[model samples]
Target chain A: MRLKTRPSHREKQLSEDKNFLHRFGYAQELLRDMGGFSNFAISFSIISILTGAVSLYGHGLTYGGTGMMGFGWPLVALFCMMVAASMAELASAIPTAGALYHWASLLGNKRWGWYTAWINLIGQIGIVAGIDYSVAFFADGLLSPVLGYRMTETTTLIIFALVLVSHGVLNHVGIRIVARLNDFSAWYHLGVVLILVVSLAGFGKGELQPVDSLFRLGETFSDKPYWLAFLIGLLQAQWTFTGYDASAHTIEETIHPRVRAPWGIFSSVAFSFVAGMIMLAFVTLSIQDVHAAVSADNPFIFVISQALGSTFGQVVLWMIVLAMWFCGLSSVTSFSRMMYAFARDRGMPRSDWFARINKHYRTPVAAIWLAVILSFILALTDYFIKLVNPDTTYTTLAFLTGVSVVGLYVSYGIPIWLRLIAESKGRFTPRHLGPWNLGKWGRTVAILALLWIAIISVVMVIPPNQNAGIALIMMMIVLLIMDLTYYRHHFPGPEAALQVSPEELARREAEFHD
Target chain B: MTMLGVLLILAACAVALAIGIIANRNVRAFNEETHESFLGDRKERDAFEDPSVS
Candidate 1:
């Protein structure tokens, strides 16, 4: 008899990943160009420190003073790490695109998965909109001096659309290019943030704040109690820590995903937490005058410009804008993957088109365009609202950001809670426990994640001002209506539709190789 | 520096150090275990991949 040769490590890994995909009735449609580092890079790029920390610094300072930066950031980061750890465990167990939906389906039922998928889809789109709009704000700032005028709402909208389209085009190219960009983005964020911090510390012209000021709980922009203001200030950290799910959502394109995906999710949050805290300390300490900084439209820009000369500050701002653009681009990649996966399992409308991978590029081109177009529409709506009612006091960014956080965190919590219940009852045995299993610590972390998400969900919906709760209610109403109508009759959930019997999966795998 | 500022700095250091150590240890353990397990499974995989097998 002829001797059979053993497959190499790389081949075994690829074969195992392919078999996992076959179990879900997929045929390795997307190119698997991402390694562990690239997987981590995607999540880190999405959680770009330059994007959230810079955009929302003034908001945090206004609500909770410098103490928010000093204390609240680490506190929120700790809770977010807990949430990420729990989700990482689940991601390792499933290792699929649209990870949250698949986890919910396997852990709970199809109905649960359907709702989670929709919520995750909405959240991803919102992230694209929010990140791009922030990019437009910075881009306009960068161009205004050269253009000899500040950007009007219309001009800003144009910039936003252009950025969105550029991101969509880049995503359409292929996963390889996207992974490369994300890898570059990760380094850019780390290097730029460190450079900015060091520059501010070394060459800052302004007198540093008294050390107590960093920890002093001072006045708020809102009339609420000090505790509530502090709680509200936590939004900056919470938002910054999001989109780590991008790692899980792109698990299908990752090598050694069972081990790598979980580490990607965990490490992204861990690294961001440390880097963000250090950056916050440098920026907050370098603030010359708290009142002047907070009063300016962009406090971060104000602080940098005042301390480090306008030219250097502008250069830093340009770097941040580039980082945010990369952030939005990576978000599109992640959002399109989730949309394609959902569509492939017949969970979306026009499934046939959205599920189609470009033969040449090997990408979900249609889904990428759809995500960007929706983001563009949302950005346009925000611009139009500002133009028509400049004095009406509507907070478009706040509402959109709230919807995004609440939806994403709730979707994250559902599967975690279900997994906790199943584990406690001794019914949740994973078919293949990935390398990063939490073992005994899993249950405790899951409980804490659920609690943290619950608190943030309530905080997200209860707006600080009048007319702020409308978005949350609207999202609920839409979900309710869907549950009552279309989804009730037609949705069989991801498990029923995607899972294949062992024999059928074997047959399909053989055919796929052929 | 104020006590709070010192405290904040110390806390940041502690968090960074603790998480760094944990992540490093876990990653090392994973690599070692995976290497051993893959070596142990080579024969079984060879048998499984054989076309003449079941």
Candidate 2:
């Protein structure tokens, strides 16, 4: 008789993972160089606390005062953790590059999945544009003294384009390099944020705000009700918590994804929550004059420069600028992977080209460039809007960011809600639970996540002014029309286009069940 | 800080700790279950494919 030697543990795990990919009708295309830490790094890097917490601190302070930074952050973080937990369950279940799109389709239906994919794609593009532009804005301020000239909007736009292109080039190089940069990015964000917080706590020259002042209700800088202003202030936390889906989107490139990807999603949010709150507290306490800080453009920058002096503050700001650039780069990586996966399932026009992997670099070059180009277009559109009507500039950009955040959260909520329904109805039950499973807590977390998304979706659209609300409604109408006319007929969804033969799927399923 | 601020900070820590513990437990349990199930499945498949292996 022939002897059969058993495969080693690592070999067995790789084989099963590859078989799992085969069941989805995809070969192992992307290089799987990412371990658990690298998997976590991508999401952590994309959700760079330096980018959103510092950039948008003024917005929160304007509407909700220091109370938002002190009290509102943890509250928002708790809710976000719930959402992240729900997403982790789904990530473990599907563990594909399509991520949310694949989960929605498998749990719900093709139409739902198509809408989810489009919304997520739009959100990814918007996020890339927003993050890169924000970086450009900061870089402009940082370089103005060195350049001896105030940077204009056109100059910033040029810088934004260059940043976007550079991110695209780096992503095209390979996943290995991207993973290394993201690993570096995770530590850099934590180290720099810690340094800044410590500096503000110890050496800040301004008189610190009293502890009670941190939680006391203050002015909203608006005529709206206090509660409404507080909700608006929550945007700082909401926006920062986004793009953690980066981990899920990179599942195909991650090792032992069924376990690692879920943990990646959960731990990124958990760490960000703790670290973000500490940073927020320190920055809020360092603000000497609330009115003066709020009145100044880029209040966080103003506070930093004032507290630390221009030279030291600029040096610190350079660190943030680098982190933001890394944030934008990681965003592109996530965006391109989503685009490639969606296209691979024939969800977009010219699906074959966008889905093509570069043999030389083992990266999706076409998808990366497409995302880069679309983001550039979005940024250019924002620039033109400002040039044409400066009065509506803030409102327009706010509307875009609003749409981005709403779209992504809505997409996230849909699958979680559907999963909840599926589980309750006994329609779907995961045979192999991922390491991040909430178990009995899953239902409670999913329900709360859905509710939170529903509330935030409304808050996002109605912000800044009524024009934003109107624009949001118009955009929804456009999406619906496009869905009915084109996508409904052409899109095959993830499973329809990517699933293997029934017998093979059954065998794989049976093996897992065993 | 106000009582509310202190409470908020304490609550944040509490929530973080609770979730961290839950996550750690889940990871450990999941690893054990997955490893055991995978080995069982492989043995069953091997036995079925080759009678002599049994």
Q: Of the candidates shown, which would achieve the greatest DockQ relative to the real structure?
A: 2
The digit string of per-residue lDDT tens for model 2 on A75-125 reads 777878888888998887778898888777766666667778888887887
TM-score of each: 0.89, 0.90
**Cα distance off (Å), candidate 1, residue A15:** 1.5
What is the per-residue lDDT of model 2 for residues B7-51, given as tens digits with 9 covering 90 to 100? 877776776577667766776666534421110111111211333
Model 2, residue A487: what's the lDDT?
78
- For model 1, residues A14-99, the per-residue Cα lDDT tens digits are 77788766655566767776888899999999888888777778878888888888778877777788888889878877778968
Q: DockQ of each candidate's interface versus the true one? A: 0.08, 0.16
For every model in order, what is the iRMS? Answer: 12.4, 11.8
For candidate 2, the chain B TM-score comes to: 0.53
Model 2 CAPRI quality: incorrect
Off by over 4 Å in 2: A1-11, A393-397, A430-432, A465-472, A497-514, B31-54
